[model samples]
Target: MTQPDDIAPYDLAIIGGGVNGAGIARDAAGRGAKVLLLEARDLASGTSSASTKLVHGGLRYLEYYEFGLVREALGEREVLWRIAPHIVRPMRFVLPHDERQRPRWMLRAGLWLYDHIGGRRTLPGADGIRLDRHVAGEALEADYTHGFEYSDGWVDDARLVVLNAVDAHERGAVIRTHCRMTAARRENGLWHIEAGGEAFSARALVNAGGPGANDIDRLAGLVPARGLRRVRGSHIVVPRLFEHEYAYLLQQPDTRIVFAIPYEGDFTLIGTTDADHSGSLEDVHIDARETEYLLAAVNRSFRRDVTRNDIAWTYSGVRALVDDGSGRPEAATRGYELPLSDEADGAPVLSVYGGKITSYRHLAEEAVDALSKRLPALRGGPWTSKTALPGGDFAATEQPAFIAELNARYPFLSPADATRIARAYGTRAEWWLEGAKNWDDLGIDFGAGLTEAEIAYLQEAEWARSAEDVLWRRSKLGLHMSGAERDGVAAFMREGG
Candidate 1:
């Protein structure tokens, strides 16, 4: 095919609506570039919704000598918190001292490195404590007497992706969910593409498909990256194991770590077991072996032994990790690579592989910088880090005060409801809450305070379509709803409400 002189309208067309893709879309759009984002399903419906929910440095990665990766992730903890305080909050993790695990001095040294290497400022640094006297000790086995405390941050991982897409849209990017890219070919110095049965053209294309990157690369007429591996991580949610808000990082004999964190107010989120995934990537689920392994790990650490019946919900996600050749799935590297391929006469194509949730912002910035060499429309320096995400304009530390204000402003809302709204939507909760007083004003109560007005708003603004999108991705409200209520919500969405 002969090359043409005409240019495409969109400077960048991003495939995948997960964190990485959304982050890139937001960054490029803010830099005054014309952008288009496409997702095969609802936003965050894939690995993004089921993947890691924390915005912290992976402490266990330290043992693997991934110092650079850990430090990079650690530095983003407070930055992400400052930028999205409503959804990202500081969390203190309690690592109880086990005689069978690493020695006390080694633990102390690791904590010291973790604290100072990241340039700690607002959050508290690590310190040793007596579990026997600490509130976090109540649910631990009696043998545990001492523990180490460290600071990290937890995020509504799905919302983080959604907010990025929302910001990207607000900044003049076209975000189209349920649109799958079917084909791509380089022609006339541009990307001539077929997606969702529609033809389009773009100056550059980014394959940020995460775990499904292999399939996406083939569609884009390129070979998949070699030595890539998919690691499946599974987690379970059960009734609260402890009354306190503290989270635990338990060390198993196999050198694996499991987290038991307070979740959704009344549940405890325990997980996860990492193993090589040989199953289908389209549908990831926790197998019996993974579930049993998680249960055993939790049972060994906590005083209360929870069985299968205690499990309220379980989720599994597969993340594409760079194979470290250690043969252990847990040993795979969490670091990422953004390879931009620019031939002598075709539009540039950038593919992302193996990135952690905590460092997505940095990864996106780097990706944009790589593409900027070819696309002159991508102007300006990095700006996504400094600006607050959608609905996150307020100061990070003022969340509690904001919750209090929500209660006062909406006197009809209970304190719990106010807190949930503030955490999910932050300053934007008032978008749907401002009205004639009382819960009825919000419309149909689908249980757990999920209102019809809110569902409509999500569909209109956040690209939510099905009940699963609302219940699972948009909010974890399904965890609190009865079966009948959940079915009712499904019916409503199916009826196109």
Candidate 2:
């Protein structure tokens, strides 16, 4: 193909719209690189949205001696909370003591290391708690009189991914959803890429595909030196088992732990079974065995006898972890490996192997630093850590005040609705909410809190096309809306779009 002067090559082209890819795009673009990010489907439609929804230091990783991974992830918790206070907030977890599991002394030691090892500064330290005397105690079985209380964070996993892409786009990065990469090859010291029936060129490429990283490597005609172990993490949502705010970290019989978290104000989120996956990546769903396993774990720990009938919803996602030949899927390392292909052989391509959402910012920083060596257009150092994602511009402590302000500005909004909008959009909630003096001003109420104005904003700016994108990924309002109400939203999106 002849070179076209009209078409300028992007400094960086990235595959995948998950946390890692979007984070890298944000970092690279802020550092002055012209970046392009391509996603096969909607952003965060893969493993990114399917996470356990935590910005936490994997406290259990201590058992596997993954000190470095835990420490780095711990350090990111505060950073994420600081930048995206709207969506990220502190949560305390109650881990009941099970005599059959690890001994008390070992648990204490692990908690101590977890507190100090990661340079803990903002979050409260872990301490022993009398569950019988606590609000969280009401939901637990009588056998659990004592446990440990520790701090972690909760995140809107899908929103986190979307906000990163939104920030990247605002900073000059091009984000294209439904643009799957069909082929890629290094030619004439540049990467000529084909995706979604379109052609493009970039000085450098990034294979940040989470579960499909290996597939991307094959597409680029490169042999991967390391193997990836794809592990499935499944979660289930049930009716609220506990009324209190505190979450539970239950120890399973198989030496694995399950979390029962307060979700969407009306349900408790649980599970996250670790299973080695070798199935097709499309439409990943919770298996009957995994569902029973999670139910058994929760039923054993909580007072509620949550059977299969109580399951409100279930979701499953596959994680791409570095395969270290571990006997168990959970033992596989969450630490990512970024291998940069030698520029001497061809155009450099950085492939992201494995990482959790907590350390995505750090992972992106490291990825950009390595790629900067190959592409000189990337001129700045790390800025994503201090910078806020899109709507998250206010201080973390000011969120409550922001919500109050929203209520004052839009007195028509219910307190719960105000809080949701504040948390989801932070300061930017005013964008679509502008000039709406009453509920009807926001357009057709599709029930639950979704309105026509919000849907328009989602479509115009957030790349949301279908009703499912609005209902599931962008927000969990699907769980709140009735089937008929959801159909109204769907019909509106179809005809209105």
TM per model?
A: 0.97, 0.99
- What does candidate 2's lDDT look like per residue over 148-208, in tens digits? 9999999999999999999999989999999999889888888999998888899999998
- The residue ranges of model 2 lying beyond 4 angstroms of the native Cα positions read 1-5
Q: In order, what is each prediction's RMSD in angstroms?
A: 2.0, 1.1
Show the colliding residue pairs in model 2.
Answer: none
C-alpha displacement of 109 in model 1, angstroms? 0.6
The CA lDDT of each predicted structure is 0.90, 0.92
Instruction: Kindly report which residue stretches of model 1 are placed more than 4 angstroms away from their true locations once superposed.
Output: 1-8, 343-345
lDDT of 1 by residue, 1-497 (tens): 22233744589999999999999999999999999998988788777888658888899899989999999999899999999999999999999999899999999999999998886789998889999999999899999999999998899999999999999999999999888888889877778778787777889999989888888989988987645788889999999999988899999999888999999999999887888888887789999999999999989988999999999999998888876687788988899988888467478999999999999999999999998889999898998788999889999999999999999999988899899999999988978888739889999988989989999999988999999999999899999999999999999999998
